[model samples]
Target chain A: MYIVVAYDVSEDHVRNKVAETLAAYGLQRIQRSVFAGRLPPALVKELAEKLRRVTRGANADVIIIRVDKRALDTAVRIGPALPREGNVHLH
Target chain B: MYIVVAYDVSEDHVRNKVAETLAAYGLQRIQRSVFAGRLPPALVKELAEKLRRVTRGANADVIIIRVDKRALDTAVRIGPALPREGNVHLH
Candidate 1:
């Protein structure tokens, strides 16, 4: 499954720490404060637990998104059909 | 740009309302509680504003993920090269 996790961290230190942990798990930083990756269910559970521990009391809002296998396939197949300009492609 | 919005709704009624609004904006529901879509920056801001109003005090965590044009293009271009079976593709 493809999962995208986004969080709003109140403290920069805590954000960096959490980002480090996620990077260790092979998550890619895709935006200013968002991360994306593909992981199995067990890995997701583990990552969520670690994140909860590290982000406790940091005043952060975390959202974990799971995109199923089917949607991912649809996206990949349709993506190439979309217009491409510079480096922008929509799937 | 490709954007994914995921939220945890405390109440079922509010969740449905918010989902309805998102669908009206061309966002496709890929999971039970997650929606995916492509939108411009202005549309994203407008959607965020409307989501805040509809989900006020509903005890939900909403995360908006923005994937840059370059990353999106990369994903699209590489997605087909990955393994494919049973409607699952990764980029």
Candidate 2:
């Protein structure tokens, strides 16, 4: 499953923590606050739960969107579409 | 069909115009640079082409993501999930 996580977090520490947690889950930061990657369904659920706990009391809005590969294939890009970090690298 | 249009533009005028064009297409601003909504496949292509033209000479990166309803239904929100604008309104 392909997942996109976007967040608007006010508190600095909490925001960093959220970013760290997401990175730990292997989600790549597409934008400053948006992370997207492929993960198993179970891990996706776990990631959601973890994010929910992190934002329980903070002033933050986080949205997680899951798209299948079929839908993702239809994605269109205009301008610098950077290669995602942590993807397979040729040496 | 659900579509997500995210852009990073360097010019102010072009940025505002991009936003206006996206709003005209009925896509809601989820984040400062991100817009999401439901649009037909044909319109999605048109929007992509229009955005492409607008960003042709500018330093901008725009991505259009199309997802099916089933994929979007799995979306999870943490914190203030605002009611979508221009959606069904009760009078």
Best by lDDT: 2
lDDT of 1 by residue, A37-85 (tens): 7887789778878887887777655556564434333332111122431
Which digits, one per residue and each the tens of the lDDT, describe model 2 over residues A1-91?
A: 7877777889999889899999999887766677778889899889888987987789877777876665555567677545642121111
Leading candidate by TM-score: 2
Over 4 Å off, model 2: A81-91, B81-91
C-alpha lDDT of all candidate models, in order: 0.59, 0.74
DockQ score of candidate 2? 0.60
Per-residue lDDT of candidate 2, residues B3-33 (tens digit): 7777778899999989999999998787667
Q: Clashing residue pairs, candidate 2?
A: none
Model 1 steric clash total = 0
The positional error of residue B61 in candidate 1, measured at the CA in angstroms, is 1.0
Lowest lDDT block of 10, candidate 1 chain B: B77-86
Which residue window of length 10 is worst by lDDT in model 2 chain A? A82-91
For candidate 2, the docking band is: medium
Q: What is the lDDT of candidate 1?
A: 0.59
